[model samples]
Structure formats: C-alpha cells, structure tokens
Target: MERKKRHPQGSGPTFDQLSAFIAQLEAKGQNLDNPWLMTKILSKFTEDIQRQVLEEKVPSDDTRWNLRQQMHCLDMVLTQEEKIELQLPKRSEIKTLESSKKEYGKTKDIRNVKFCFYSDEKDHWSTHCPVFKDPKKNSQHLKNTNRCVGCGFRSHTLAECKSKGCQRCGKKHHTSTCFEAEASDFDRTKVKSDDARKKTASAGHNVVDGDEEDDPEAQESSTENSEENHTVLTAKHSATKRENQEGSNIFLLSGTLRTKHPHSDEFVQLTVLLDTGADRSFIEATLVHDLELPQQGSVLMKLCTFGNQKTTVKCMKTRLSIWDICGKQHDLNPYAYKDLTQGNVQGVLDIKDLMYINEKKIRLSSSAHGYIEPHQPRVIIGCDQLWQFIKFDEPQFTLPSGLLLIPTIIGYMVSGRKFQNGDIPELLDIHDTSLA
Candidate 1:
C-alpha cells in the first residue's frame, strides 16, 4: 500500500512561534537537506500565521515587517550602486575643461554662472557688469584714422593711398599724360640730361679715339661690321611689316540660313548679325509666306522689361548656303524674325543665332566709326556680326567710304543672288515640258 501525504493546517503559527521553531530546529542540529524544501516550509508556516492573525484580529510584533523593510533597503542600495558604476567615465571630461580654461583664460563655470546671475539682474541693471567685458573691445577693433597713400581718404592707411594727379590742374591724371606744360618740362630736363651725358660720353670717346688711332685697322673693321648689322635689322623689320599687313586683310562670315515657303516653292535666304545691342531680327511676313518655310510653331521669348511675351514665328527646316567673296557656300539654319520695324532698316539680321566660323569664313570686328543713314541704301550691319570679320582701326569713323573700302582677310563671296519669287520653279517646269 502507498503512504498518503499529510497536509498542513491553516493559521498554524505566529512570528514568535516561528522564531522559536527555527531556534529549536537549529539547536537539535536538524538542518534542512534541501534549501528549496526549507524555503517552502517557511512560506507555508508564515501564510498560516498571517491568516490566523487576521481572523483573530490580533496585533503581531514588528520583526516580520522590519525584515521586509530591510530587504527593500538592500534592493535600493544595490540599484544606486549599479547606477553610480555606469556613470563612471573611462577618461574624465573635467580635465579637458580645465585645460581649455587655462588656454583661453576663460572659465566655463564663470561663463555659465555669470549668465545665470546676469539674467536675474537684467531687469534692474542699466549696464552689464564690469567683469563681463566684451571680447571684441580690443585695440584691433578700432580702425586707423590715417589717410590713404593713394587717394587721401581718412578711413584707410598709407599703403592704400592713390592720390596721384596733375600738380598744376588738380585733375585726375595718369603718368602717360599729354599736357603741354608737363611735356615741355620733360623735354627740357631730357635735353639737359642728354647734353651732360653727351659731354661725358664725348670725353670717353676722345680717349677711345686716341687709343684707336694707334690701331687704325681695328677701327675701320668695327665700323664696317656695325653697318652690316644695321642693314640686316632694317630688312628683317620690313618683312615683318609686310606679313602683318597680309594677315590684317582676312575675315570670316558664318551662320547664314535659307527657308522655303509653306504655300509656294520659293525660298528666302537670311543671315544673323549676332548683336546684343539690337533687340531682334526683321523679316517680311509676306516674304515668309511667299517662301515655303517650315513652321516649328510659336515660343515665348522674354522681353527686357515685359514678362511672358509671345511671338508667332516659323522655323526654317533646311540649311542656308552662305556664299563668301571667294564663292564658297556654307549651310546654315534659318531663324524667323519677331519684329520688322525696330530693326530700323529693310531687313534686320539676328546676332544671337550666328555661331561658329569655318576656316574659310571672313572675320570682321565691331566699331562705332561705321555710320548708318536712312538716305543711303547702305545696310547698318550691327557691331556684333562685324566684330568677327575685321578689327576696327579706330573707335570713331572719319569717312563713310572707309567702311566700304575695308577688305576681308579671308572668306568666300556668294557667286550670285538667291532666286526669289517663283522663278526657279517656273524654269524647272519649262525644262520638264521641253524634255517631254
């Protein structure tokens, strides 16, 4: 037969009874074989005593409560110790702060604490504390009042002065001035210096001549060598001048365009001047319609002052053949005009669209001297396109004919004028019929 387990009764023992039981168990040397079993026994006995005390309404001693309090105190101490261990740094930051304070001569603690006190007293105080002086109030902050060496202004130093001017006129002047008084003074000084130098040189030369007279053959040979050298130098200078003149005659013309009309078989040839001064290119609407040009539709081009301006223009599909004086033809795309009147002439070419010059093209430079007149049949080509061709000799023009006579350095001229109207198609039809 198996033995039945005995169950313990409720409300069995008080704190005093439990203590006495533990004491008796220790005195008999009857130690618990298993620690878990002893713990379970102690728990059961405590629960039973608590239930009994609650039912009897009896007050117990504070030993059990004191033990629990001790346990809580021990748990709190352990937690505090763990937190302190975690906060401990491998290397202290306070040492770094102290080193910085020594280098900058400013304490971080003072800065932080001073701000706190200052903030509290700000409403009552009219000025900052004397100890809290601004770092920017040093002598370096105060600018020097010395005048500039060049311009005589009080805000700058002597090295920056630029006060050079004409001594007599008090006007701004350069070293290369053409004033009569300055020229006269310079010439007089130069003449006097030259006279002195010549006298000294002549005395030296007299001594040298005397020495050379003793050796007549050497003197004659040196004179002959100097003459030969002079002749060679003159010939070389003349050759260089001729080469420069030849190079000046070359010029280039680029960005020519041709377009065909949509309705007719005719085409219009055009070229852009590439001038920023002139606003837009000029083309007749009738001429565009007459030529069967391709239209890429309209685009919004920004005006100088106005915003979002729209213009109706066509894009020419085929490249134009630009012919030079040498009869060479270049292929170029055509750009339509926005306005015809602002151009001031019959047809205005655009400067922007013209880009890239071939090796064979002529070059012309921009100049103000070239004149444009309403009476003359002359076309006022803008400076932008002209600059690419020939460099101007002067800024202002003295003669109108000078512009027409100026020759291009290098470029081909168109052999003949492009066929306008319906001439080419009519001739083609005649040829076809004759062949049939």
Candidate 2:
C-alpha cells in the first residue's frame, strides 16, 4: 500500500523528501533501482509534475536513462515547477477590497468636507467666492495653487482628474472658468455639439463607481504625477534607447532586490523598479540568463508601448525570492522579457528639496540614483504584486517641490517631477499596459 502512494497535489513534496522516501524503500530490501521501480516513482509525482516530466519522453526513450539519471531529471524539473507554483498569486489574494458604500452612508453627515479651495471658511462653494467669479483669475489660481481645474483639488491634475469635465466646452476644467466661449453661447454650443464631442464629455465625466480611496496604493502614482512639473514621453519603445537629455527628471522607484543563489545559500542582489501601472511583473532576459535561473514555463504576452504600439512576444516565467526592508523574504514569479528599460534620467531633486527631506529625517531607498550612470532595471514589479510590497500604515509625505515619498516593504519610493531653469523636461512614465 505504501509503494502505491502518490505525491500530494498543490505544492507537492520537495525533491529531497522523495529521494529520502526512495532510499527508505531501498533499505527495506526492495530493488527500487530497476526500470519497473523507476516507472512507479514517476507515477507517484503529482499530476502536473508527472505530465511535465512525460512531455520530454524520458520514460519512453529507446535508450532510457538509468533509475538515478531519471530521478535526477525528475527532481530538476519538479524543483523548478514547484517553486513557480508556490509563488504564483492566488485569485483570492488579488481581489480588490469590497466597496465602501455602507461606510460612506454612515459618515456622510459628519464628514467635515471642504467644498471651497480659495476661501478660508471652507464652508461655501468655490462658485460663491468673489475671486472664483472671474474666469481669468480662477484659471490662474488653479495653476498657481497646483489644483485640478476640474475638481479644484491638489491631489490630481486636470489631465488625470476623474471628476466631471466642464459643462460648457466639455474640457477637463471647471465650467465657470472655461475661456473657450462666452457664457451666453454656452447652452447653445453644448446642446448642438457633435457626437464625438458628446462622447468625449461623457467619457471624461465617467468615474469609477466604487470608493477610489479604498485603494490608496493605486492613488499614489496619480498624486505624484499630478504634483510634478514634467513633460510626457509619447514615443514608441523609447525606454530601450539611452537618455542623455539634460534637465529631465525621470523619477521611478528603483532599489536593489535580493534573491537566493540557485546553487548556494548566498543571496543575489539586482536593481529593480517598482511600477504600480503594470498589471504583471517583468524581468530582463539577460539577467535571468546570467543568474542561471531555471525557467518554469513560457507565456505569450502582447506588450503595448507608451505610443499605443503593440508587439507579441514569448516570455519565460521564473520564480524569485526577494528580501524586503524588514529583511522578510517574498517569493515572486515574474515573466521574463528581452529588455524592459535602459534610460536612467538623473538630477531628480534640487538642493533645497534634498535639504527639506533631510531635515524631516525622511528615508529614501536610493538617494544616489541621480548620481549613478545609466542603468537598465533587471526587474519591474507591477500591480499584480505591487500591493504586497507597499506599507500602508506608514504615512506618505509630499515634498514642497511636489515629489511624493511612498513607504514600501522594500524601502521609501521617491516619485514625482522636478523642475529646472532650462527647457521643459520630457519624462517617460510608462503607465498604459495590459496583459492579454
């Protein structure tokens, strides 16, 4: 009966455990090294591992491997596959939090909401304010105060704002402050607008139904982008090229991550960028090859660049164990790509901003990132596993210069735009990605 047992499903027994079991059977006077015994051992593997091993025809080959050789191959494949299986995120683990409608209803009356931005009273609406009555002054006020022209908040910009757009021009700005047309013609133009214009207005007004504040991590990048003063990079596959542009403040959260060496106990460290925008994590193929990381499987993925260009590529999947800020190890299974990004735009912060952060005793993951030469990140941790690394209890701080410092399991991640006296800085914040 014991000889008929099989490896359990899910994360099955380790290679050492199976080897010890076989050794125990041999100690009991069983001739387990024979072909028949080898076949039985192969059958004992979990369903998935068995199927993988059989795919290469090890058992059916004309010149079959001996029992020891068969065991070695099976063990090798089993180790790689099981590691990936264990690291893969479960469906339940990634589910978004339930809506906060009930919570909102309970606290709606006493929410202490601020309806106006310009007034010190905060009780009256901005429309009632004397200064907001002037369209030109209202527009200038929004820009100078770094407020969203649509929602009139400092949290997000007009381009990124999710609130309702202007009712007059259908643009992402307040209707009262719209300079596109006079107030007398507003009603006539809005009603007679083309279908495309109406569609744009409808799309701009559509907001996510549920409470967005429930996921603060998702809001971090948006807040950083809105506060920063930088230009947008719209070129296709621009990350592969070298960026020698001066005055560009390309800020992406990057730090050194560690994984255990496959052949030894020592840890291997590699620089990785944390991106909340990407749905799935990615690793550079060259780094995987250099590290001798065993490939578990392959995935066919269509990668869409910043300029809306799409390319389908086959990505190899592998498991990695990375250590966080508190020295806790996390297992991640990431898809491997030929390349991710090569541009490293330094000079992110000026002297005054640095001094302010230092005075506040703020922690940063990679303060010297600006001083370093161009480097391609070996890994990019996307939204799929990004929340696992974020530290929610620790409050995030925004510098007077508009850069946000976010706390993570790895360390503090610096984000946002920096301004210099030269020409406008063109930055690449690769956010539009979908995994099909």
Candidate 3:
C-alpha cells in the first residue's frame, strides 16, 4: 500500500467543513474525475485546508506540467468534447516536443494503425520501415489502389496526399479549427497558492479563485486607464485593531437587483452595498458595454485621492434600478466612471432620502471613532443637497463605559469608538434606564 504524506493540520472548523463536503460527495457515489469540480471544491475549503490537501495530493506537479504531459500521452484517446473540456494545449502550445515543421515526423491521420508509406502496409510509417526507401518496391506500392485507407491512393501517407483539407474551411487546417469552442477558466487567471495571495489580501479577499480580473476586464477604454470588473474598492482606512470586531456597532444591510442588459435577454442578480460617506457611485464599463447602457449626458466631477490630490473625472449619467430593497424598486440616476476602487460596486447613488434615521440619535453629542471591520460594500450613498433631512436619536445621558446606546427601528445604535471595517457597534440595553 502507498503511504500518504502527513500534512500540516487545518483548523477544526475548516476540517469539519471539508469532511462534510467530502461526505456529501461520497454519498452520491462520486469520483473526483472532473478537474474543474475538484478545483471548484478546492475553492470552498478554507485557505488552510486547501494548503493541506494541495500539499499532500498535488505536491509533485501543481504547476500544470503534468497536465501537458497527460494531454499529449492521451491525445489519441481524447474525444472532441474531452479535448475542449480539458483545455489541452493546442498542437501549437506544445510544438517543442513535435518533430520540426520542416521535417514531417511520423504524423498519423488514420487512428490506431500506423501504416508504412514505403511498403504500403500497416505497423510502421516511412520513418523506419525495412523497405521504406527502396526504389523498386515504391512503384509496386503505388500501383496497388486496393490497399488505400485514405484518399484512394496506394501506399501513400495522408501527409503526402493531394486531397483537399477539411471541407468546412478552405484552410489546410482541421475542420474544428475554424469554429470557436467553449472557453476554459485557464484562459484567464492562473490560480495561486494561499500563502501567496494572503500577502496581498490585507484589505479584502476575492470571493472566487484569486484571479478576479477576466479577459474582457482588461480591454482598453477611451480614457487613459482601464476598467475594473466587479472590483470591490480595497482602499483601507486607519483604525486601531480590537480583539473582537464582531461586537462593534455597525449594521450591514444588503439588497439584490435582477436586471438584464437592454440588448440581452439574460437577467442576472447583482448585489449592491450601501455606504453613506461616498459622494457618488460607479459601475464597471463591462456592464455598460454588455448591457448596452446609454449615456444620458456627461459632467465634470472632482475626486479626492488618498494623497490629498484632487482630480477631475468625467462621469456619464445613467439610470439603474434595484426593485426590492425596501419593498419597492429604488431607481438611481448615477454617473458612471472608470478606474473604480473596487469591482462589485455598481454605482453610488444619492439615497439619503430613502433612509429613516432617528433624529434623537443623530443629535447625540459624540466625538469617538467607530470600530474597524472587514466587508465588501457594492454601493455607497453620499449625502449632498439633502443633508438637512437626515436625523439621529439623541442620547440624553452616557454610560459608565462612555458608550451611548441610541434606539433605532432595527436595533440600538451605540456611539463611542470610530467605526471602520464592518465592526459591530456597541448597543445600549434599554434596561440600563439611562434614557428613563
């Protein structure tokens, strides 16, 4: 029996999650035959569990070298669909191993049987047959038309045949080369190791395999810079770290929009994050191009950078709607811009009017920063001309810990420390009797 290598242990919860997922798969009598599904499963495992499994099972050739070798060794056995599904390198990708193009190395057209072009029979090609180069047998071989397997030529190889190539396209290449095939994820980003990505995931994490950018996302725009598709703004804010950020005073409400590009019949669910500090919302140019969103007009907008430099950006006005956030479709007429901070952020809209803030909480005198948290916000709400309409619950008194708990419709709003990163804010317990 083959012994498996001992791997670094994973966290208990992560191990449990992996075990449950595997058990479910096993209950269905499934084998890990599909590489894509294996990769997809690998993505769900926590960062540590993935490292363990990859280190133990795929240590030798995780860089895809083995895949290339398998593709070539099983080239003859692979079906048309299999060839595409596997993303096997094209005849062109592994050209180094093939015989020089100038020299037609023993190329096979008819599968399974290797025929000798010189002797005009099976088992070997003209490369090394005993009677391959004989001048006398060559004439006899050509005369026997009954022994032709392809092109009705006696003892001639397909490479030397005068027959026209694939009928589908006028080109000499194979018929399959003319049409486009389903694309593989390999065509875009190459997945990286966990430790390798952790170094860069300080601000946020990629929901999918680390390669967040797609091929279409790299296209050039009319502007100098390129667009980011579904990129969540990763700009970090300064905040002191706390032991338990889950208890910080913060409320995260999310909504989904079912929309279809005007030109496309396919409707997709897009999630948007709501933030108050952002002056305007933005969307990726890919959504605009794919959905064929029309530009109503353009305006000059000033943007403040982390470095304190101000830059003027040209934004286009477009309308987007999310139907069921508060039981009604909220429509936003926002301006679209390129080079957004993050991906998933569709657009920043002026939504201060939709919110119902407690006036008493807003009037409470507080001078402390909030907690730091980690989360992805897709939409930011900016308070502009309608700032006066905002209201907050006023706290008449403070707690022993200097935290003020203000009541709101959803939950109590606590004010004390600065809020950053999705930290749960401290809430005032109504039993404290400070307000009474």
Largest lDDT belongs to which candidate? Answer: 2
TM-score for each candidate, following the candidate numbering: 0.21, 0.41, 0.26
Cα lDDT of candidate 1 equals 0.31
For 275-306, candidate 2 gives per-residue lDDT tens digits of 65465677888878777777776654445443
lDDT of each: 0.31, 0.61, 0.39
- The regions of model 3 sitting more than 4 angstroms off are 1-255, 263-267, 325-328, 339-375, 384-436
TM-score of 3: 0.26
Candidate 3 residue-wise lDDT, 1-436, digit = tens: 1101111234132323444566687689876446785556455434644555455554465555332232232222223334454587766656654644323224433434676555557766543366535433443454454423223344456566554643444544222222311233464234435454565456232111223333331333224233332222212122223423333332222233445556565655553333333434555555566667777665544444344543445556666654432234455655565544332221121123112123223321111122212333333323221132122552333433433444322123333433334655544211100000
The residue-level lDDT of candidate 1 at 148 comes to 31
Answer with 1 or 2, whichever has the higher TM-score: 2
Per TM-score, what order, best first?
A: 2, 3, 1
For candidate 1, lDDT tens digit of each residue in 68-150? 33223333433444466569863467676576655221333222232212223533321243432332221122223232322
- How many clashes (backbone N, Cα, C below 3 Å) per candidate? 51, 0, 41
Candidate 1, residue 388: lDDT: 39
